[model samples]
Each structure stands twice: as structure tokens, then as C-alpha cells.
Target: MTPETNAWDGAGKRLYLQEVGTRDGFQMESVFIPTEDKIALIDQLSDAGLAKIEATAFVSPQAIPALRDAEIVLREIRRQPGVVYTCLVPNKRGAERAIEARADELNLVISTSETHNIANLRMTREQSFAALSEVITMARQAKVPVNVSLSCAFGCPMEGDVPADVVLGWAARFLEQGATGITLCDTTGMAYPSQVRALVADFRQRFPQAGLTLHFHNTRGMGLANVLASIAAGADRFDASLGGLGGCPYAPGASGNVCTEEIVHALQLMGYDTGCDLPLLLLAAARLPGLVGHDVPSQLLKAGQRLDLHAPPADFASWRDRALARDQPQTAVS
Candidate 1:
């Protein structure tokens, strides 16, 4: 596509953002964020106009002690009318717990690579699908919408360079089995712009009615670039974390998920309506380092918005006067 034609196509269009910080971000934190703190963050995010928030995961406490208080956080948070509260469910039990906790949606995850799937879920691809199938059935019974996030969709740390068909095959299976949507995840930040564009185009054509969300990580610093490519290829939904606070243990050199504030800032500047309040998002992001007990990787939070102007230095007038006088030459000095 021509640059001029593609440049303005996404302008003035509506895009949906799924905030995965509290669940995905907190899961990787070394310290446990207090249950109350998690609730407060979710409440703040809800007020900030996030389209969807992955509040927490209903996995085994031993597996993910950081988010062990998932049910409590879900029950305590103030639910906004338009914001969807999603819970990541690992199995049927997790699905049951999520539904009991009154989650608006259930997000299930699987990987396209068999090795990665076995490593993460302790099962082969078929085994993982069988277990997830039970969860999907439970969600259907509970009348809750299910969105399956296919991890390592773009490439796998273990297997490397997962084929497009493998990713689409998993996505198609989930959609055929009653999933409300599919999130193509770059689990290790291996997705590039051209690959994202090609895959997204094929996905849209193959499943015209299926809902699509792109999940990216900034490990290789191409997360935002991949997002732009997806947008160019007609994918508008994405999963991003606050403060860029998440990484995969299985993927070496994995840093964090794409920062929510940074992506929103970029998209807003590009004229896309993300439906998020950028100022409020920054305010929430500013509190992340304190909660996580360390500095975060949010570039926007570190270096405010592009248009946030700064005044001149205290001695700027004297410096400018000296420089001006110096440049004027000695001819006028007499």
C-alpha cells in the first residue's frame, strides 16, 4: 500500500484497548501487590475509560502467588458500566472461579508451538486444547463470553518462528468452538511489522466475523511498530500493560509488555480515538513504580508528552544576551 493512502486510513477511527497490567503485569512482580492495591489500580483504570481490563488470573495460588487474591480483587473493585472486567482462566476450575467472581469475560491462553505449550501449561497442544475446551464449555454454560489469547502466535522462544498457519489454526479452532474473540500474542516480542501485517490480513479474510485483538511485548523494541502494522491491516484491538511491567520467564531477554500509556499517546497523536483519557492513564502509570517497588519502563511516563513544554533555564536571558552580543562583532562596540 502507498504511504499516503495508509497514513490517513486509521485517522479518526475508533480503537479498543484491553488493559492487561494488573493481571499480566502483577503476575511477574517479585513482591505481591496487596489485594487492596490491586483493587485500587483496577478502579483507577476503570475511571480512566479503559475498554477492557484483565483484572486477575484464577490460577493455582502456588503457581502464581502474586495474584492469589484474584477473587478478592475482583469482588472488591468498583465495576464501571461500560468497562469489561476479564479474568484469565487456566482450566475449568479457574473458569468456575472466574464466573463465581462475576467476571464480565474469561480470557483463556494457549501457545501455537508445541514445545512452548508443554513448557507453560505442562501439556501438548492437543492436551492443552482438551483442557481449554472444558473451560470453554463451562464459560458457555455460565453465559460468559470467552476470548482465547494464543501465546507465541508470531514466534516461540523454544521452537522459534511459528508458522502463520499454526497460529491461525489455533485461532480458528477457538472461534469455531464458541470463543467470543481471539488475541494473537507475541509472547516473546518476536513479531515484526511485515509479519504482523501479513498475518492480520489473512486472519481478517479467513474469519471476517471473529473479533481480533493483538497482544505484543517490547522485548525487541518492535512492539509499537507491530501495533501500527496491525492497525494498517485492519486490526484495532490490542492488549497493553501499564508501566510496561511484564515479561515471560520462558523467553530469554523478555522485558515487558507494550506500555499502555505509550501506545495510547502514539495512537492519540495519530488521530485514532482510543477512547482512553491519556491524562488519567499517565496519572495511574505514575503510581506504578511506587507500587511495584522499582522503576518501570514507561517512556511516556519518564519523559512526559511531546507537547508538554518546559520553560527556559534560570540563566537563559543572560546566556542569550551574551551569545547575541558575541555574535554581533566589535564593529558596533565603539
Candidate 2:
């Protein structure tokens, strides 16, 4: 489909798409996507009009070997104008590496569950916060924007039922410590629609100016439902991966992120402008199965759109007449 020209107004109605294929999507894959291919994907996504792209993570290679080429990928990627390239940093060392890479933004993740936090980062909540503060300070010094993500904010696979107070308290502290933005991450795909609405509503009310983003996984098939709830609760930013190509290696049964093309298609259909090129996003999703050696879960990429059936049999003149008639105003007959 052609890009929308006068389709969206520039105002509070705008929705932002943050493409996470490079970080979240590729991190779970066994195959090693060359740094050149990673850079090429970022260039294509930038041209597709994505506002932000999580380019890579500066974590330990032992933790996630797929992203070991973070520095090379970040340095080689073509930085498009108006697109914010971000990197995930796990600790002070990771933050230092990201700073060396001259990353545009640094994203830090902290878990709400004590057990998950200890298992994931080998630290207590207090220790994680302390490390996050240091990383935020380092990013500030390097003039890079710092964003903190609260993982398992909805529910934890190990601990189960993460309380709202726990999430809100952590968010308050992160903001107090100078977080430029905050993302609520459903790390294990256990969040429900009602829970999403309540959390986002409370957070938006408390932190009016906070740059709020939601990250959802489709493990139980509630990813899109949660996204709708968050949007209704005043969230405008969301995280999605191409063809939903990711999962939490630490959290068993956790699936990949919400599909980027699926989310973009939903937003465009709802008249909430995302500025993403859906046709191009479909092309990107189509490439994922071959690239990763598995079929992705994106519906739009597989089934195509209902509107795509408009000109079956390739009759150009007849299709043109039908299209013109559909676009014209309907009149009452005598």
C-alpha cells in the first residue's frame, strides 16, 4: 500500500512505534545475523518511518551471545534523521560499553519480583537500583538519554502476581533518579487487559510528563489486548519486533514481543496514526522466517489484509472502475 499523505494529524492523537527487532527479536535466535545484515535491517526500518529502534544491547556476551556484536552493529548502522537508536545496558560495565559506542539512548531493565531480579541479574532490588542510578549518572555525563524498563511489572512466572504498589514505587524511584523515560515490560506474557489498564492509568496519572512505553509478549495471546488497554489508559509508545521474533531465554514459555506489523496495522485501522509503512513492515516480516529458520507469528505477514483481495484475477480496468465507484459518494435513488 502507498504511504498515507493526509491520513493523520500531528497532535495528541499520534502513536509512536519503537521497533525492537534488533535487540529483542535477534537475541533469542540461534543463528548469527551478520552485523551488516543487522545494519541493513535498521536502515530499512528507518526508511519505513519508525520513530525509535532498539538497535542492540550492551550486555555480557556470556548472557546473550547473539548480541555480542553490539558495538559493531551500532557503529555500522546508518543513522537516519529523526530516528532515535537505543541500546540496552544491564549494568555499569554495559553502560560504559554503550557510552563508548556513542549510543543515542541507553535502556536499563529492572525486575519487580525479588526472586526474578536475583535470578536475572544476581542482585537484590536495592542492589539493582543502586546499579541503575550509577548507569543513569554515567549516561547523563555522556549526554545520552537514559530510559528504565520495569520487567515483570504485570506478573512474574516464578513469584507470580507482582503488586501494583511494587511497580509504582519502583517507577517513582526510577523517575526520582533521573530516568528520561520508563517502559512497563510484561516479560513473561502474563499481563491481562484489566491489569494493563489499571497500571497504565495509575502511572499516567502520577507521572503526567513521563515518557511512558509498554512492552508486551504474546505468549498467552493477550499481547494485542494489553496494547489496546494501555492505549486507552493514555500510553502512546509501544515496543514491537519484526514478525514477533524473540522470547526470554531466562523465563521459560515466554514468547517473542508483539509483532511490529500487527501493531502498526491495528493502529492505522483504528485511525491512531503510527506513521509506519505497513507494506514495508510486511516485507520485513516476510524475511524473518528465512532469516531465523522458523515461521513467525505475525498474522498480517502470513494472511495478508482483507483489503488485499480487492483486485483478484488481475483485471486492471474492471478493478479501477470498482475502486472509483467505492470511493464516490453514495446517492439515494428515486
Candidate that scores best on lDDT = 1
Q: How close is every model to the real structure, measured as TM-score?
A: 0.95, 0.87
lDDT of 1 by residue, 204-307 (tens): 88998999999999998998899999988888899999999897776555668999999999989989899999999999999999999998889999899999
lDDT of candidate 1?
A: 0.90
Residue-wise C-alpha lDDT for candidate 2, range 1-334, written one tens digit per residue? 1122232322436888999888988988889887788888888898888989999999889888889999998898889989999999999999999999988999999999999999888999999999899999988888898999999999888998999999999999999988989999999889898889888888988888889999999888898888888876767799999988787665555557899998888778767778899998888778788778888878788778657775457688898899999988888871
Going through the candidates in the order shown, the clash numbers are 0, 1
The whole-model lDDT of each prediction reads 0.90, 0.86
Q: Clashing residue pairs, candidate 2?
A: 246-256
Per-residue lDDT, model 2, residue 299, is 75
Q: Which ten residues in a row have the lowest lDDT in candidate 2?
A: 1-10
Q: How far does residue 1 in candidate 2 sit from its true spot (Å)?
A: 39
